[model samples]
Target: MTDTLATAEIESTIRSLEDARYAAVVAGDIEGFAAFAHPELLYTHSNAAVDTLDSYLEKLRTGFYVYHRIDHPVHKIVVVGDTVLVSGEMRADITAGGVRKQLANSALAVWVRDGGRWLLLGYGPTVIPGAI
Candidate 1:
């Protein structure tokens, strides 16, 4: 396939992965999270808090964050070598550590192709000014 065609295909696949990963949050599916997350994932929240794979999973497992909704309006997706860089807007509602929150964020996620699958390596979001 042409490069452009390949890129489009990869983009679509990555978007599907993102959807599934986010769905896991709403479903509170631990195994689903594990399936999508890389072993070395570093998820940085809009508030600047960071979570490694283990800690992030614990956050869900212990009900520290109960995500009821997650929506990403992806602006850009690029494939560089074996990595896909995703830039997007994040809008979500969640109860974090038992406190309700509505999050509006500018987000980026790095997905690395591992073996035959895409693994989410990192996620970082900054709160959009005046968008909470």
Candidate 2:
């Protein structure tokens, strides 16, 4: 395939993955989360810490972390060879231990093709002071 075509395809797939991430967070569906994530997925947070998808799912299964709402506004997408990078602003409302709060963030995600499907390889975001 031509480089342009490949880039387009990768960008589209990255957007789709973002949608899935939103859906899973909204529904709090661990099953949906599992479906979209690769077993060996490496996701890094804005805090500079990294966690595997499996480890993330395990934490979810514990029912300890609950997110009430999540919204992501994409700002950019760039594709290079088999890798796609997405940058966006994120707003989230979360409640845990009876404390509910809002969070604003800027996110960057890296996605790569695994066989025929796209899997998120890395994601990092900085917490912004206010909504974007």
Candidate 3:
């Protein structure tokens, strides 16, 4: 395949994975979400709190973080070597630490190819101006 074709394929796969991951979160499927996560995943919230894979899973398992809805519109996907960077904006209704909130943020997700599969290595979101 040509380089362009290969990149497009990777982009498509990563996009699908992103969608599935968001769906898992909204559905409260810890295991499903875990399937896409790297062992050393670092998830950073817009509030600047960071969670390791274990902590994030625990929050999901215990309902400490409850995702009621998420609308993530990916703007770009860039492939470099075995890594993919996804850029997007996310708007969501969620409850964190027992407090309900709506969120609007610009998000970045990093996925790395490991052991012949793609796993999410890190994710971070920054609150959009005047959006919460």
TM-score, per-candidate, Cα-based: 0.97, 0.83, 0.98
Task: Report how far off residue 69 is in candidate 2 (Å).
Answer: 1.3
lDDT of 2 at 24: 92
Candidate 1 C-alpha error for residue 14, in Å: 0.3
Off by over 4 Å in 3: none
lDDT of 2 by residue, 1-132 (tens): 987887777777788889887779568898887777767777665456677887777666665447788889899998876677899977787764356777688998877777877777777778886454
Q: Which residue pairs of candidate 2 clash?
A: none
* Model 2 stretches with alpha carbons more than 4 Å out: 46-49, 96-98, 130-132
- Residue pairs clashing, model 1: none
User: CA lDDT, every prediction?
Assistant: 0.93, 0.76, 0.97
Greater TM-score among 1 and 3 belongs to 3
Worst 10 residues of 1 by lDDT: 17-26
Best by lDDT: 3
The worst-scoring run of ten residues by lDDT in candidate 2 lies at: 94-103
User: lDDT tens digits, residues 1-132, model 1?
Assistant: 899998899999999998899889899998898899999999999889999999999999999999999888999998997899999988999999899999999999999999988999999998999986
lDDT of 3 by residue, 18-116 (tens): 999999999999999999999999999999999999999999999999999999999999999999999999899999999999999999999999999
Report the number of the highest-TM-score candidate: 3
What's the CA error at residue 108 for candidate 3, in Å?
Answer: 0.5
- What value does the lDDT take at residue 112 in candidate 1? 98
